[model samples]
Target: MINKMEAKHLDFYYKDTQALFNINLPVEKNAVTALIGPSGCGKSTFLRTLNRMNDVIEKTKVVGEVLMDNKNIYDPDVDPVELRKKVGMVFQQPNPFPISIFDNIAYGPRIHGIKNKQKLQELVESSLKSAALWDEVKDRLHDSALGLSGGQQQRLVIARVLAVEPEMILMDEPASALDPISTSKLEELVRELKNNYTIVIVTHNMQQAARISDYTSFFLNGKLIEYDQTNIIFTAPREKQTEDYITGRFG
Candidate 1:
């Protein structure tokens, strides 16, 4: 499979403290890859580097290359805005815009200069349908996004990202705050989405990662300890640290 994104000897620093150390990994195209480790292990930090989301952090410095489709995302000529458009992100908590549901999904296209109401309506419907949310919100297109349930809000966020037609989706513990049913729905949605988009998720739930991901990368203290097929990583990790971490011995 083609590599959608590659990180080479990546290291990150926040002020004087080092957060990531010589990390390297390739995210496969059209597959769900899970980044798993204990809290503060830099999983989220690593996810941010792919789309240059770390660039906005004050006093933060990043070393090495995050190459997307062979183009260095950190190159001086690379536009952060455009890079973000190609790589959409969904946060741990559902953050819907304080506007009508239709406007929320239409925001991306509007920013990119899509002005036709009919075109926007089509995009909204298609995106919402793609995210498995159109049916629920179809009747409430003009309703405030805040009025939706947690699961619906998260799906709305997904639809918003999809509206931009991003090549990759970065999810940072996307279902962590949801109830069991909602989380299951989100997981099912992720499975369905991998057919069209490359997905990289940073998750703390080991079983969730094992259940949904095609590949799993294990990190410990900012270093990649293991990268393998989901089954191998969970059943027979090569590194002792990975084995220990997955077996509940230690992080």
Candidate 2:
């Protein structure tokens, strides 16, 4: 399988405290890879490292490499802003920009120099459709995003990310705050999206990981305990720690 992203011996530190240790993995293209672990096990921290989201923290440092398309993203010549545009992120919470639903989806294209009104409309429509949110909000394009339900807002945030046309999407506990029905919708979206975009999702819900991910990586205490096909990871995990965690022995 072709890899869309990779991390090699990656270690992350926040000032004097370290978070991730010597991580190495390949993120396959057009597939979903799930990261699972207890809170603060470095799952989210490792996710942030992919697009240099950790760079915003003061006195933080990354050691080793994170490569995209075989090019090291951590190279001194790389521009984080441009890199992020190609590797969009969906946060744990739906954070729409307190604007009209249409404008929220159009924001990325407009920022990237797409000035034509017709073009913006087309992009917004396509993006919203891609995010599975078009039908509900198509007529209310001018409506404030905050007026929508939590689930719609989350999908809008996803549509906003899709508007940028990124090759990969990183989600950090994306459905954690949604109702069961909404979470189901988001999972369906994630499964469908993997057909065209590489995806890495950090999720606490084991069932969610099993249902949507092609591969699963188990992390513990800032270290990778196991990585394998989802079926094997959940059914016959090789590591004792992984098995224990998956079998309700311990976190």
Candidate 3:
């Protein structure tokens, strides 16, 4: 499998406190990789480093390399905005714009200088369809996005990210706010999306990680303990800490 992204010796600090230590991970192209750990374990922090999302915080510093396409994304000359366009994020909660459904999907494309009405319309339709949300919202394209159910809203948020045609999709507990049915649907969507987009998901649900991920990484106390195929990690992890965590002994 081809590695589309890789992190080497990644360490992160917030103000004077260190949050992540010497982390290395290789993300396979067109595959879903799950980051599993307890809260405050640096999964989200490491996820943000891929697209420089952590740069938004004050007095933060990242040491080491996050590379995509063999180029370090942390290089000073790299444009984080453009990198973010290539690598989009889906948050834990659905945060659709308080605008029409069509507008929500078209928002990214519109900002990227796609103004032609027909083109925007086509983009909206394709993105929504790709996110598996088109049929449900096709008729209500002009309706406020806030009116959609939580599940629909989350899918719509994914569609919004899709409009930009990203190469990588980073999700942070994307289904944590949804119902069981919604979570199931989202898992299906993740399976489908991996055919075209490399996905890295940070999830608290062990069953979820097992259900949808091709690879799983176990983190504890801000360090990566083990990373392997989902089957290996869950069935026969090499490390006792990993096995313990997977078996519900301790996190």
Candidate 4:
């Protein structure tokens, strides 16, 4: 498998408290890799490290390398903004701009300097379609995005990410807030999205991980315990900790 990104001996700290330890993992291209663990296992911390999202938090430090396309993204010269553009993020909650749906998706591209009206419209249409939201909102393009359902808002946030043309997408428990039906729809969307975007998702839901991810990494107490094929990790993990966690023996 072609690895789109890799974390080598990665460690992170919030002030003096260490949050992650010696994480080494490969994110394969055009596939979904899920990070699974209980709360405070550092899954989200490690996810943020991928695009330097942790940089926004004061007194936080990262040690080791996160390589993208074989180059260490943590290198001094690499711009976090540029890295973030290549690796877009979606949070646990959907956060759509309160503006019109058309403008929300257009926001990123416009920031990146695409100014023509027709081109913006095309991007808006295509991005919404890619996110599986165009059919629902195509006629209501000028309507306020905040009026959308939670599921629609989440998908709209995804469309916003797509508008920027990211190579990789990071998701932090994206389905946790949705209803079962909406969660299923999001899962289906995730399955479809893997054909084009390399996705790394942090999910507390083991079932969700099994359903959507090609690879699964089990983290505990801020350390990586096992990383393997999803089926194997679910059925025959190499480590007892992984097996225990998967079987609900302990988190």
lDDT of 1 by residue, 1-251 (tens): 79999999999999999999999899999999999998988999999998989989999999999999998899999999999999999999999989999999999999999999999999999999999999998999999999999999999999999999999999999999999999999999999999999999999999999999999999888899889999999889999999989999982
**TM-score, cand. 1:** 0.99
Model 4 C-alpha lDDT per residue in residues 1-251, reported as the tens digit of each score? 99999999999999999999999999999999999998888999999999999999999999999999999999999999999999999988999998999999999999999999999999999999999999999999999999999999999999999999999999999999988988998999999999999999999899999999999999999999999999999989999999888898983
Q: What lDDT does candidate 3 reach at residue 242?
A: 90
lDDT values, one for every candidate: 0.95, 0.95, 0.95, 0.95
Model 3 clash count equals 0
Q: Per-residue CA lDDT of candidate 3, range 144-247, in tens?
A: 99999999999999999999999999999999999999999999999999999999999999999999999999988889999999999989999999988888
lDDT of 2 by residue, 184-244 (tens): 9999999999998999999999999999999999999999989999999999999999999
TM-score of the candidate numbered 2?
0.99
lDDT of 3: 0.95
Instruction: Report the C-alpha displacement of residue 52, candidate 3, in angstroms.
Output: 0.5
| C-alpha positional error of residue 223 in candidate 1 after TM-score superposition, expressed in Å | 0.7
**C-alpha lDDT (0 to 100) for residue 223 of candidate 1:** 91
Candidate 4 colliding pairs: none
Off by over 4 Å in 4: none
Prediction 3 TM-score vs. true:
0.99
